[model samples]
Target chain A: MPLVDIQLIEGVFTEAQKKGMIEKVTDAMVEIEGEAMRGVTWVRVQEFRSGAWGIGGKGLTTEDVRALTS
Target chain B: MPLVDIQLIEGVFTEAQKKGMIEKVTDAMVEIEGEAMRGVTWVRVQEFRSGAWGIGGKGLTTEDVRALTS
Candidate 1:
């Protein structure tokens, strides 16, 4: 089973967006692994509090993520 | 930076237990990599909904996890 865990800044995604992400991530894993893995694939979305998630020595906030993604 | 994600059955761990897990997992990553990596280490503990997480063709519930761990 391939378990995918995605971490992002809190409040960046709505529930619908997260659901889409889970489906797409699982699909990607199934495409690479095999169709049999589809039933066993698990995707978890975790939102980190501001200042808790850091990249390149800088903490990421929702605004930072928005700017980077948008 | 190493990101460690732990997946488990929901309701299996208390807040304190999860906190301890986060600390230990981060420490393990740091030990394997180096001391400098500790600052950027991210440990996310995810609890999957019952009947959603499967292993070896069987779904895992809190009771199953408790039995296995105990």
Candidate 2:
């Protein structure tokens, strides 16, 4: 079973986007693991609260992530 | 940076339990990656909605998970 975990800042993505991410991640894993393993592939999105996810000793907020996209 | 993602069935764990899991997971990674990298270590817990998690092509519900513990 291939399990893919995607982490994002909370409020950054909508439910539909998360669903799409799960589908695409599963497909990506199946490409390597084979179609038979599709049913066992699990993709879950986990969100970190603002100021909880740290990088280089800096806590990132949702606005910080949004700024990166722009 | 070491990222540890833990997937659990929703509603099965309390907030304190999850926090403990995060701490333990981070410690486990630090043991391998060293103390200097601890700041970059990320341990996240993602929960699947009841009946959304599947194993062997069978969807698992929260009740199914609780039953396993009992």
Candidate 3:
């Protein structure tokens, strides 16, 4: 079974986007693991509090992530 | 950067258990990746709705998982 966990800063993504991510990520894994594994492929989205995600010794907030996106 | 994602059936674990998981998983990765990488190490726990996780072509509910534990 392939388990894919996606972490995002809280409030950064809409529920629709998260659902899309789950579908696309599962499809991507199935592409490599083969279609038969789709039933066993698990994709879950985990959200961290705004200041809990860190990179380069600094915690990142939703604003930080959104700034990078734009 | 090492990212560790743990998936569990929702409502089975307490907040403290999840916190402990994040700590232990992070330590487990640091043991392999080295202490310097701790800052970049990310351990996330994602909980799936009961009946969302599947194994052996069958969807597993929270009770199924709890049954296995007990």
Candidate 4:
């Protein structure tokens, strides 16, 4: 019901953590994207190494990013 | 944060439609699963034939399911 296709970058978050992340991400998208909450959905989650997908090019595993203070 | 790995099977829906699904799914997970909305997310949307996924095993494409009544 949400975007048919989507790719997400997530890290370190445990199963519970991931669940929470999805909830919030969806809420934000609905608020910001002006989409119906019922229409929201989960697509895909991609794990990345620190330097692999973010700015600053720091070497951080998905776990590292999740644990990052800032 | 939220669960990091999740596999989702979704039926027919547009980009906006998918987005809405994510938002709602996340919210539901939060309410029922007691996870944070932020942790919920879009994982993977696998297009299934009517019979490919869901009950009755009816041969329905993703669209058929999305448009399904009830």
Best by DockQ: 2
Docking class of 1: incorrect
Against the native complex, each candidate's DockQ, computed on alpha carbons, is 0.09, 0.13, 0.11, 0.07
Worst 10 residues of 4 chain A by lDDT: A1-10
Tell me the tens digit of each residue's lDDT in model 4 across A1-70. Answer: 3332323344444566545545565664455335443364444444544455544655546655444423
Evaluated on CA atoms against the true complex, candidate 1 attains a DockQ of 0.09
The local lDDT score (0 to 100) that residue B36 gets in candidate 4 is: 37
Q: Candidate 2, residues B1-70: lDDT per residue as tens digits? A: 6766677888887766766777777777778788899888876666789999899999999999989987
Model 2: per-residue Cα lDDT at residue A36:
96
Q: Please rank every candidate by DockQ, starting with the best.
A: 2, 3, 1, 4
Q: In candidate 4, which residue ranges exceed 4 Å CA deviation?
A: A1-11, A32-37, A40-43, A54-57, A62-67, B1-70
Report interface Cα RMSD per prediction: 5.6, 4.5, 4.6, 9.4
Q: Put down candidate 3 lDDT per residue, A2-70, tens digits, no spaces.
A: 898887888888899999999999999999999999999999997876644544324566898888887
Candidate 2 vs 4: which has more lDDT: 2
What is candidate 2's local distance difference test score? 0.78
> Candidate 1's error at A20, in angstroms?
14
Ranking by TM-score: 2, 3, 1, 4
lDDT of 2 at A38: 95
lDDT of 3 by residue, B1-70 (tens): 6766577888787766777777777777778888899888866666788988888888898888888877
Residue B20 lDDT (model 2): 72
Task: Specify the highest-TM-score model's number.
Answer: 2
